[model samples]
Target: MELSELTIHKAHELLKQKKISSLELTMALLERIDACDEKIGAYISIAGEKAIDQAKIADEAIAKGNISPLTGIPVSIKDLICTKGIRTTCASKMLENFVPFYDAFVIKKLKKENAVILGKVNMDEFAMGSSTENSSIKITHNPWDLSRIPGGSSGGSAASVAADLCLASLGSDTGGSIRQPASHCGVVGIKPTYGRVSRFGLIAFASSLDQIGPLTKDVTDSAIMMNAVSGYDRNDSTSVSVDVPDYTSFCKKGLNGLRVGIPKEFHSYKGLDPEVDLAVKNAVKTLEDLGALSVEISLPHTEYTVAAYYVIAPAEASSNLARYDGVKYGFRDMDKKTLIEMYKGTRSQGFGDEVKRRIILGTYVLSAGYYDAYYRKASQVRALITEDFKKAFKKCDVILSPVAPTPAFTIGEKADDPLTMYLSDIFTLSANLAGIPGMSLPCGFSKSGLPIGLQIMGMHFNEEKIFKTAFNFEQATEFHNKKPMR
Candidate 1:
């Protein structure tokens, strides 16, 4: 296997045996990025020299016999996650040149483990769109087919893993950012329960719904990553103080006695693609064959998930994004005569169309006359959605479904229709709404050869259950071993 294609587990084994050096692995991936990233548009910036320096440090640690699963692994960070010295653009002109002095909590964890930081990857502007076409910098293409999108706003993160440009990556999930892209690119992406991973330096999109998680080449790699980054941080008030388990231990071979729930609402959606439905159903049957009991469950409020999410997420986005005005830092419009004009001009010129659209919709919803009618109602509906999941979990250990309604569409296919683009995340929005753990793994491929994903959701903070279920399914099928022919 190519050095760049090695999973975190494999790389660690080789590195510990002195069969390969961290510098060699890092160089291989750097070379791979040089060759493939231009065609994939998976990165916003590449820190070649910085990455090599980190790799050298990792090698020194490995020589000392002090290495973690990720000690020398090459990993990518979604642009939205702040890195102390590296440029963290969030794929928007608003902070296009911004650099932070402090790393995100997850970055701190990775740094402590000596993981080589490859570079920052592209995404939707401030993580506002379902397709990466909303990126102000570049549109990330699926490694499976260059003509199609790699999903978003973590499109770059998923594409990098799919293309073997990076062994694994960190991505923020708000709505379906991480899982949707992983589904499209045929990789494993997990969104931990809200507060499971600290969000100290994550560029806020929807404060209540946003989470940091892993996008990796396989389920085992995802587990290894979760061990390093999942924990509490004193800096983030929203971070939970719960104890994190060894996620890798959950990747066992059997699913005997496990109960899998099939939400009637999810499977019955009229917009679901026939191929995606079949792929997910087959995944469920594979689990059943492995001794899991399948049960029919109802999340009665499922239909309101999209509406509630659109309201709550955008409203929080508007509030969180208000700090990007020209005053403090980031891009400033020097030509503006007054402070107010500067704010208006900078935001109007800096943010992309989708970001502006969400901000406007958010502002309108949070406006005095509409707050009680829109935002307040959405919050109530959000509670109902949460209740639905809580009640469903009473019937099964995990819930299974399709990650998205369809395989990745052509780039620009839904660019003109905002509503259609929004609907793309219909199956994924509820998890964020309910603040639960969710994951997407490769299940099958479409007739056109695009990858399909099977989503497994567990109760809040019960990632181990989801991991066990996904791992069992992975071991039973060859889907996780399939790579895109770029």
Candidate 2:
């Protein structure tokens, strides 16, 4: 079975009726991973036996009629997320051998739902870099075009779903990690409102901006996957205390009265491919045809998002990574002669260049003379970015924008230049800073035949509205049906 063709809802029905067992579903994914993962390099480590054990338990529960929408679905987890007994490397040598005794809040949620854990997918080291090239182990190639990159740091998760190695996967989006990769892979990915989903088990990138979200094959599946994991958790201090709603209940409410805001700033971004721009434009036309309204708007503070995020995110990363010293946990070089040697050797050997670079920059900004100048000021700018979204939401139900300036670039195109690679995250940084929900679904293909994504951003805790709108758009277009030549 092509796992990508199976919707989360359909899998649930099949499981409840005993037409399929969770063990069989898990085996199917394991078989798919065995067949295609070598070509895609999606999974850093596939949990063959452990996943089957979980599936057997799921089958038992379903046979007893204790069912959920995700009861029998097999899903992959990004390596950044701790999976207890499973090796939870954030694609960094630092934690390559470390395994958490506890599960992340999201992981616990999935276990309760009886979802099969496919394995740990690869990602950038310490969640740095826009491409998975920063991974300490191996590079994750794009399933869309093997020579090009699958966007990171969620590249492995996106590639797995795109190549049908798993039904869906969880990814963290601090900047464009989730959306960018989803666009590159031609799948559905959503970065929920910060705090909407708990971040307890996720390896820190930017604590304030980071979120765990689902990457699946369609809007409906995205909603179903989201439902299984979203909600407040006491473990994560930043988790919001909002009421969780029946997200799937509203998935079919067509976009009849939806008001979508299209920011004018998106059209004039430098180096935006003409084909991608045209594709987004056509998407607006399709929305109108489906009885939705699109109106031009301006996020006047859009330009500051990138500048502010770099400073703010790094400041947090500098602090978060401090725990990786040899004395604490993770990587430790045993042959060190002195205390300083031990600390230096462990970090130098554990973290990749991009991760080290971010730690240095972050530390520098938060250091004595620079804190007030860079870190503090960037926080102020972050406020304005969030305010821009708050104000925009007052005028529209959802904001529609391009996921990235262009389609998937070649594997080594931006890998050499850190700044050039960071620029590709231009369109997505704002949503993270704003701490709102954002999603990227396939809008159309580029002239060169690569995929382009249309980002749907919503106000605080308004994922239902975003889902209703995206579902309507998905039903009206065939863009999501265009599979990559895997």
Candidate 3:
């Protein structure tokens, strides 16, 4: 395999054996990005000289016997994650040139491991859209088919991993961003339980629902990444102070006696594509053949996931996004004479249309006269959704479903239909709402050759269970071994 195509574990093995240098691996990836990123539009910026310097430092550390699983490995960062001295534009003009003075909690951990920083990848502006078409910077194309979107708002992260532009990448998932894109691009992605990974430096979309996770080339790499980034952080108030297990150890645990939950509602979803449904069902049967017990369960509130999530997520987003009012360090209109005009001009010109729509919807829901009818009802529904999952998990160890209702559509297919775009995450919004661990891995392909993803969900902070289940399925199928023919 080409050095740029090497998985994280494979690269680590080569680096540890003294058969290859960190510089060589870094150079190969950089060359790949240089050759292919223009067509993919996966990155917002390239670290260039800084990455090379870090690789040299990693090589020196390796020579001294200082090594870790991630040491000398090159990885990509989503533009929304703060990196000290690097422009952390959340793919919006508001903070287009903004730079941070400190690294995010996860970035700090990666740096401590001596992992070479590749660069920042694109995403929906402020992570507000599903297809990545809303990114103010660039529209990231699916490497599998340039005419289609790679899913979003972590479209760039998944695309980069799929295209081998980076060995692995970090993405923030508020709804289905990471998992949906990973499914579309035929890669592996996992979103840990809320607070399992710190959000200290993640640019907030919905504070309560947002999480940081990894998108990798395989399930094993996903586990290695989880081991490095998952932990409690004093810096983030929402971070849970719980012990994190060694995720890699769970990969080999077979599915014997594992109870798989099949929600009755998911199979009956109105818009579920026939290809996606068959693939997910086949995946379940494969697990059963490997010794798993399948049980029919009900998440009664599953139908309300999209409605409740839209209300709650946008409400938090409106509150969290109010900080950029032109009075702060972000972009400001110098020509505006009045403070209010400057605030209006800055935001009106900075944010994209989808962001503005959510802010307006959120502001409307939270208004004094409508709060009881909208926001309060949504909160109550959220509680019910959480309860639904709690009751369902009692009978099953993990939940199985389709990551998305359909394979990736053409780039502009749903761009004009806001409600249709919202439905793209119908199957995924529940996990974020329930604050549980969930993941997406390649399970099958559509007739058109697009990828399909199978979602695996586990109870709160039970990522090891999810990993164990996905790992066994991965070992049994060769779907993940297929790459996009760019």
TM-score winner between 2 and 3, please give it.
3
Q: What is the clash tally of candidate 2?
A: 0
- Residues 263-323, candidate 3, lDDT per residue (tens digit)? 9999999999999999999999999998999999999988889999999999999999899
The lDDT for every candidate, in the order shown, is 0.94, 0.88, 0.94
Better of 2 and 3 by lDDT: 3
For model 3, name the residue pairs that clash. Answer: none
Q: Candidate 3: where are CA atoms >4 Å away?
A: none
lDDT of 1 by residue, 1-486 (tens): 899989999999999999999999999999999998989999999999999999999999999999889998999999999999999999999998999999999999999999999999999999888778999899899999999999999999999999999999999999999999999999999999999999999999999999999999899999999999999899999899999999999999888899999999998999999999999999988999999999999999988888899999989999999998888879998899998999999999998889989999999999989999999999999999999999999999999999999999999899999988888788899999999999999999999999999999999889999999989889889988888885
Over 4 Å off, model 2: 1-4
Which stretches in model 1 have alpha-carbon errors above 4 Å? none
Model 2's C-alpha root-mean-square deviation from the true structure amounts to: 1.2
Output the worst ten-in-a-row residue range by lDDT, candidate 1: 418-427
Task: Name the TM-score of candidate 1.
Answer: 0.99
Candidate 2 residues 255-306, lDDT tens each? 7778999998878888688888898899889888888889888899887878
